[model samples]
Target: MASTVATNLNTLGRTTFIKNPSFKATPLNAYAKVLSKFCIIPSIEGPLKVVQQIEQQGAQTVLETVGLKKKGYAVKSHTLVKHNLATGQTGQVTAQDVSDAEYLAPVTIGSPGQTMNLQFDSGSSDLWVFSSEMPADQQQGVQSAGNSIFDPSKSSTFQRTHGTWSITYGDGSGASGNCGTDNINIGGITIKNQIIELADTASSQFLSGSESGLCGLAFPPLNTVKPTRAQTPMVNMISQSDIPKDSELFTCYFSGQSGNSYFTTGYIDHDACGGATPAYSPVDSSQGFWEVKSETACINGKAVSRSGNTAIVDTGTSLCLLEDSLLAALYGALPGAKIDHSVQGWVYPTDTPITSIPKLEIAVGSNYFTIEPEYFGFADLGNGYTYGSCQSRGSNFPFDILGDRFLCNIYAIFDQGKCQFGAVQRTSSGATTSGRPVDSGTESSTAQLVH
Candidate 1:
């Protein structure tokens, strides 16, 4: 049977507090995609619940959710809608589709307050920070967060139950845990009593990378990970408690500013970024990723159509990629772009960089957006390896991922409650073209490299 839960994140108030779009210099968000496990697993054990007691402050049971993204199907209701391809395992969407979709904030391990780093993800939803006992596999080169680590032992309401959960990202990254509890914090706000899946394996890159464990603050019916497929931590916590009932929408503003970024609950300081909150499209949850209902796709201003069903909006991703047909429609416009079946992805000659590719625009709820060029480019993939949006990943590529490089010039807002994304023009405040507060735009063209 298909598993599911609901996200209590409903956008209630729409208000701004501060506007500081001017920052000295900030870090670029890396949304690298790696392969991950996709096939579904049996239901996990127990009726997912979050119990905060003395022994363990808070612990959340993650719901195992998985899907392979490709050319044929689409997620319409929790059910898969087969398009041209029948019995196809994966799904697909266009570049513009993802840009206009609503998304959840990258949650960290800390109290509601004290949220240090917030990550925006498109591959996985099992948002969790690490606990002190995190197995050596998880510890690895990563040291303990010390005071920041969710100290389950400190919570008087800690409960030990058999909570099994697993997450395999589209990028081949994953983490798993039996069950654990620590103070679950989000946006500097505390979920007083809660439970989370304690990752016991090598989660160093994710857990302590910057903030605490992640928070899958998106749509729910979270993935059921264990043998009995139950509710996930976020879903169960909101369901079991009366806290979210008073809320019509739990909105979050993920400030992807250079540093000092945060997850603002209830209110988003639109002025803080000197950016505007564009209209957000309702979210498509059946696909397991942030999917938006789009009306069009135009290469540099020309219109096009897509054969796939969903678009994966990933901040962790780097470029704007598309499926075979849609890409053909795009590269056809460029001077040197073609599909290389040998490599199973798209490729373009270095002779041409921009392909003069027009701004791929996606429309949501009557709002039209033009994806900027900053999202396209060749990057050092490792071993001096490099690739470009004009290129494709080998066969079985994740097909479509609207990465951060595209949003640097334009503002993208994830309004989760409305199940929509907000896109606005990215202004520099006359700052540096390097996305820094300084003046660097004079050095080169407006096309800035995220690296």
Candidate 2:
């Protein structure tokens, strides 16, 4: 059944369309012969073994560095399309359903340029993708899921840096590959000689999804590549003078409804924020992740006390993570909600009434963002709860995770230059009020941030 879900992801990837021409990719079969020929670069049996050996070697010895890149300067913005991959295991997958689960953007790589849908992550720093080295069984989703393997052998400008890279997620999922340099293009903006991680071994989690790779948008200090660390595509563009110095920051706005969600590089899209003035908070980039102060949280007008609570605005994470103490206090107001060790979080009875769920609001600086009941009830446990057995929105993590589950309510901007984060209400799509009617007293007619 899990493999079937993975297969469905592949089918969804191939058929998804992008509104932008630059990020549009050719069909997989269109270059099958070329990719097949390139497959000879890494012998099938040795790829995974090589990756394991590299991991065991402890640290990599610097061999040699090649090519001093020329800088290109210009202020520009490329609009990215948000793609949602559907897996049938979930109930009634819709634009809103998966919007909070995963967010993917189309990226073009190599000379002839093959397009791959990659997750834009703000927590880590390393750009990696499925490549010719991926085993056949794991590459099943490549064709239908819009998952494409990068074949450096086919690109005229591809340069092998002979470096190894590896990344492991908090859930123990990981990928390892060889590093190289290639031309990467997004929404017509091109970043020449961008570092690319070609995965030779991928864990089952990656193989089971439509995302072909990840574009880490966080600070460069978090990169895991070996020999020498590689810069993120965004950092490369910014440091190499590829984007206008004045407009180097990027902004992301995710809308849960049919309305558009976009990732704009180099500038902010004010219209996407629904005309709401952004309330900015300083981010602590010294630790690699986009860390910010989450002053406090309130439930039903009662304040929840927390000490030194900080938040990491991570788009890659599907659910919001909070400390165990906060989780207890937050879910205490709701009936039938208990910690489910099996899922590693709190779960509520599927039959619990929506009105029984209390409102949750968190403060960032002086601004407060509220999440309604509909957004808080995460997913239904398949054992017949349908709408009743939903996971608690809060999970136990070392620090607070402001993930897509909470982020989709506002337009989020990460300004690398200013070292600050800003968020505003998304205008086109109605804020947190979903499926349920809004209470006239607590809800505003127009979506906007409150102090």
Candidate 3:
């Protein structure tokens, strides 16, 4: 029965497979991956403690750049500790390594179709890739990692443009490249002459990853192209005359079980929602994210309120991050749950029964959807502890972020034409039942979900 629903959802629209073939769900790895999405480099001091420090500082910089806070907002800085492998001692370090991405989807580019797996990020707004134009050493490293590199010379449809793009992370690592336009396709939906950033130089962090690049789904204003900003693929899809007016939206369904997650563009997967109507709230894209108001929450069926709070629905992030007070309140309700500084997040004994975890519900507009208890435990921290999915957004970040941890429990919709975000609860019989990871197979493309 579940297989039938999954098939029906895939067939209803242009769908793309979502998977992280190399990702392992360890607490350190999960936390590091989430930090990398925010451009934060995890420190070698310790897994959890350093991540918390880095996030506090990095979030402040990000919030300030987006105009969410005053330029000189007071932010505490932590000295990054670097361990010397040979000396077995820790010292101050300038840079830290990035973790592997959580998920990636196949995107076809150019005339003959050069398909590369890209990390689809809703929190950002740039579609950039490692290209053939990069330095030989960098290209070889990226290629050796089983990642595809785009060669503009091979694609007859590719056209070079005047703009240049560069993105630097907090750790001094960055990517810089030239710009071009070509036919780009995802889930069988093609957008011609879409702006593509071809990286000629990339940091080692990006070159070692399985993903070729990133497909940012946020608003156009967030695009980082120099001199003149370019429209993102999502924006181009909406403006293109070839795409139908009603087909301007995209939906994401992430399964708890591997090999089942898929993304659909051009229509909603009603079957994935189990006949429940999606409740939507107007988006505030001024800050260039899928932002919506979410001021209320319920923990263990008890009302918890915070006025004027908003959340960014970001699929790129691995865990659901909320304000510290909200996190304290939620975790406080669960017996044995405590803020474990060792992991720099809330955690409980691994032996605790699932029924013992308190119920948590977050609001989307006026409607509140319950987050299944199965998602309560995020990653396993060896030594009899399990990290909680709900973590502190910290003092620096201005808004709460609803990442895959919260997203897995619902059928999410990103309506570009309407400028709103919507979601509906998934029925018990849905493709995924928990946040636990399952063994996955090798990557493959399927037309079963394509329009």
Candidate 4:
């Protein structure tokens, strides 16, 4: 059973070989082995597009151009490539506005390049995919996912480490395989000698989806690889001098519509921000998540009482889940909103005026980000017709989890260089709205459901 409430556990699953079930990060030995050396790789200047495609291999170097001062590391920004739209219907009801639950990009593995569409997640850290080693039934299940399987035997660059790998998610969905190193290409950026997990066994949750696998974007501490930990692709980029050393920042702009979401590495898009000033929040990476401190929340400009609230900001999740007491205070502020225990969330009449609903806002720093009525109410699921029941994009969780529903409206930046997370309202200029569906989960831990 896959939990609808997507978390790090749901994405990476549990690695059996690791003794400790709790979050424990091994020291990044790969950083020293890969990034310590500073070299000048020539840059290939081209028209500024979202994602730059690498036709010919350009030398990798730190970005030092006029207008941009020479900082710790040169920033390299990559526009997020959008995959195909995944569509379906629940009776007559269909979310034409939010057709997918997640976003995915193409990642080419091996020498000849068997490209697979992978969901880029910021929660868990592991790059596992369905491979040639999987059983026939398992391979068939995910056949449409990657298009073609990654057969290590055929690749000249494949180096088998023969290290066994396995991971089980909180929702019971999991994958396991052998570990090895190979070349992985994303957009125009290529990582050489990259460690990849070749899946031999896969659960239906993964096979049933259009996405072939997942690419983690968080710190290495949350990596699920066993025996010896593996370095994530993002770390490989920074260590290999593919990006700036002092510029370890990644920004995500996930849109409600398919093919509109995009992310940039190294640089922040000031134009897509609502305000010139961005609110910076400190992150506690000890939990292997971009966890930030949220002081309080407000509804319709009215203050809602709350103590110290810590929120895990994740792009992999679809809803804005809160604890029981905290959610009670939120929904209590709404006039017609009521707890629909069956869905483990709140619901309201679909015909209810969007503007009539009180606005929900969360305080990060000195600034506050509002969850607009159109973004917060989410989909209409109760009845198939025009207006029946509208589901609130919120659920109950032990700890607060801010998913894509809450994040899409804001410009989210994960800055490792300063060990802080920054946010601002998303501006439409230079920003896209296209996207694809990624991971789905259930209401409770181990329980599976989809939005």
Candidate 5:
């Protein structure tokens, strides 16, 4: 019966169109805060293994806290690992893990509508928040950061649930919490009975930000609820009877400039793309991501072919991560471009002429979109070098990640009902390179680049 239900959900189809409202994304500008949000990508096998370990640990912890034990359940041995670029070593460490969150949106929850800032993440699928249920020390940290905490007691419609959830990222940062159901509103769209994870414990990293929580836009299977998986807000939103049949998709527009980024649901902003229609590609959600295949990339207007390169359209990530071979080919064409081990990523001399930088492009199905040269220089290294926005995924990570660096150049669409990913180039002058310029004296000296 469970298998049948899952199959039916996966095979649900989209119907015709209706227009809906959009929400603006608030860009974070504090250099220190932005640096703290850099995402550390784990090796190919690391995430799955870590997730399995966390699930088992979370289930065990929940049982112990509730004073209940399941028959024949045993804890499995597992270790959380991350690469230390500064030390050139792999080590076991517990640190505040950071997600690649650059933008935030205001979301309202509960009956009377308690609004809080939430980082919208397409790479993850759990809607979690800092809550009053956490330890006093943790609550203090959240307060210090000026972030709001969800007080379920204040919400008349809040309903407590039996499930618990815990999740650890590749960077060893994690959050564990109890579950509840409430009404959630985003951009004038309301989703009833949305599962909300209220954190009882959170790593210090999450407590150091203004954002109170995360609103995950990924597929339902990635939700961390235990004993029974719960649907994400996006899933619930689509399932709502009031939502228009045509509005089962969402679109993201990152202008690379502050105050201009926003997202729309149930409709596409064709004006943003200068009336260009998006080129669509089938999405493979088996892995619970917006995954698609890319076989070609362009360097200096020259086509470079590579096969079996699956890419994830992840807005949660800040940089564009490509396969090693493709990265080498792209960087090799530029003189003095090298992967600096100190930073553990590619960097070029700050004095390098922008005209000398080769034109770069990545394909989405049959459509190829150009990545502007300005985006190539991601950050200044303070020592006469600038970091490259496009980096290698290393030999272990199995797929390419088209993150914000790529998304800034196009209008991206995630059609859940149709199981498709779409993109169209943004030719408007309004779209600019990401990141505001800082004085050379205050430039970031070290980068936290992990693979």
Candidate 6:
């Protein structure tokens, strides 16, 4: 009577409590609280790399610098950390640091791809490739074949799907164009017939950085892309194969700026997932997002539990932020904990004594894990006047991100293809599925197939 996918659960069957039958499906479609914040409705869009840069900039001095000028509008500026590369894959924390590796180069109508990384993004649904269609004036500082733009003409999988796709990010950055196919090879996993949302915009505003193009990881209400002037990330991936369709969820490791990072598919590594494990909460199918049901939050060894809150596991977000009153109450437990609330939210002073901070724990699937006290301080918080704290956001009610900050403490898996998250606690003990030990702590596994 058991499904083949259910049977393939490996050791996780006995380890995780499958109290909710829906867990076997796809990721929990919890309502995305920030859905309305998406004024620019994603046609499809959008973390980390904060460590080595900080060390090179002098970790102490970097923390103290603040004063947001008119450099530009920033939706959210988080201190990105690091996540490790899977077993045989070689990963570089910062793209520049890995000069020798062959990065993914997206082509424009004008020429072929020059250099780029198979960047992994779960934030928005649109994908852009440098294009030759762009006016000659805007294409400076970058090189592409004359009128050839890194054409996918050579790849057998290459094809142009008619439609104009574009999307603007919360940060105001945007990209647009048509759709194309290519042989996407990364981490040794190749999706030979991968369908890519090729946004060959006449302009290159969004395509001007270390990143080349993005591989979207979101599943629904999100698949807006259409052949008739619309396209979706799900549509493209689904067309490629049923692999993405088999599951109900998809996740991004979202490791910040410390270690190397990559896009993990098929299942979530148990050990990589962090946060406390709480009693099984109900899933709100209508709400959307892989929303988990949690009854309360445990703050610093105290019972500061409450209900009606969802932690969004977005690869798009770089930092973790809880509600104001909740964070205050939580930080209230710490010594000399003064909150800087000049902005819509609050930020903790870096000089605050770390010892005074209580261990904050979040209970997820079947275990409870504590978020490191250091991750809470500003990148410079807790260090003296020499280091400056990083920027933060806490305006959203009951908002907390299970991002790289928390993930670094453990190995996690986003079984987005399936609605469940297979997390391995005590991963440092080496419980791994990638043929290696769970580098973080305890956890690791696989899903039959989904997304």
Cα lDDT tens digits, model 2, 301-398, are: 66554546677787765556665555666677777777553333466676778677766777665456766565675566664332211122221123
- C-alpha lDDT (0 to 100) for residue 246 of candidate 1: 31
Candidate closest to the true structure, highest TM-score? 3
Writing each residue's lDDT as its tens digit, candidate 6 over 65-133 gives 221111231223223222232333222223221111111223222123233343333434444555555
TM per candidate comes to 0.59, 0.69, 0.84, 0.68, 0.78, 0.58
Native RMSD of candidate 4 (Å): 18.6
**Which 10-residue window of candidate 5 scores lowest in summed lDDT?**
1-10
Compose the digit string of candidate 4's lDDT tens values, residues 77-195: 32211122232211111111112225666788888888876767676677877788999987876675434577888888889995666654322235788899999876556679989
Clashing pairs in 2: 10-144, 10-145, 13-145, 13-146, 14-146, 72-241, 74-244, 75-244, 350-388, 350-389
> For candidate 4, which ten residues in a row score worst on lDDT?
29-38
Model 5 misplaced regions, further than 4 Å: 1-100, 428-451
The digit string of per-residue lDDT tens for model 1 on 127-235 reads 5545556655456434543213444565555565676776643322346676544444443344443456666664333543443455554455455445544433345
Worst 10 residues of 3 by lDDT: 442-451
- 101 Cα displacement, candidate 6 (Å): 18
State how far residue 78 of model 5 sits from its true place (Å): 7.8
User: Which scores greater on lDDT, model 2 or model 5?
Assistant: 5
Top candidate when judged by lDDT against the true structure: 3
For each of the candidates, the C-alpha root-mean-square deviation to the true structure, in angstroms, is 13.6, 14.7, 9.5, 18.6, 10.9, 15.2
Which regions of candidate 2 fall more than 4 Å away from where they truly are?
1-101, 135-146, 170-172, 257-259, 349-355, 382-397, 426-451
Clashes of 5: 1
User: How many backbone clashes can be found in candidate 4?
Assistant: 27
Give the CA lDDT, 0 to 100, for residue 256 in model 3.
Answer: 70
What TM-score does structure 6 among the candidates reach? 0.58
Candidate 5: residue 171 Cα off by (Å): 2.8
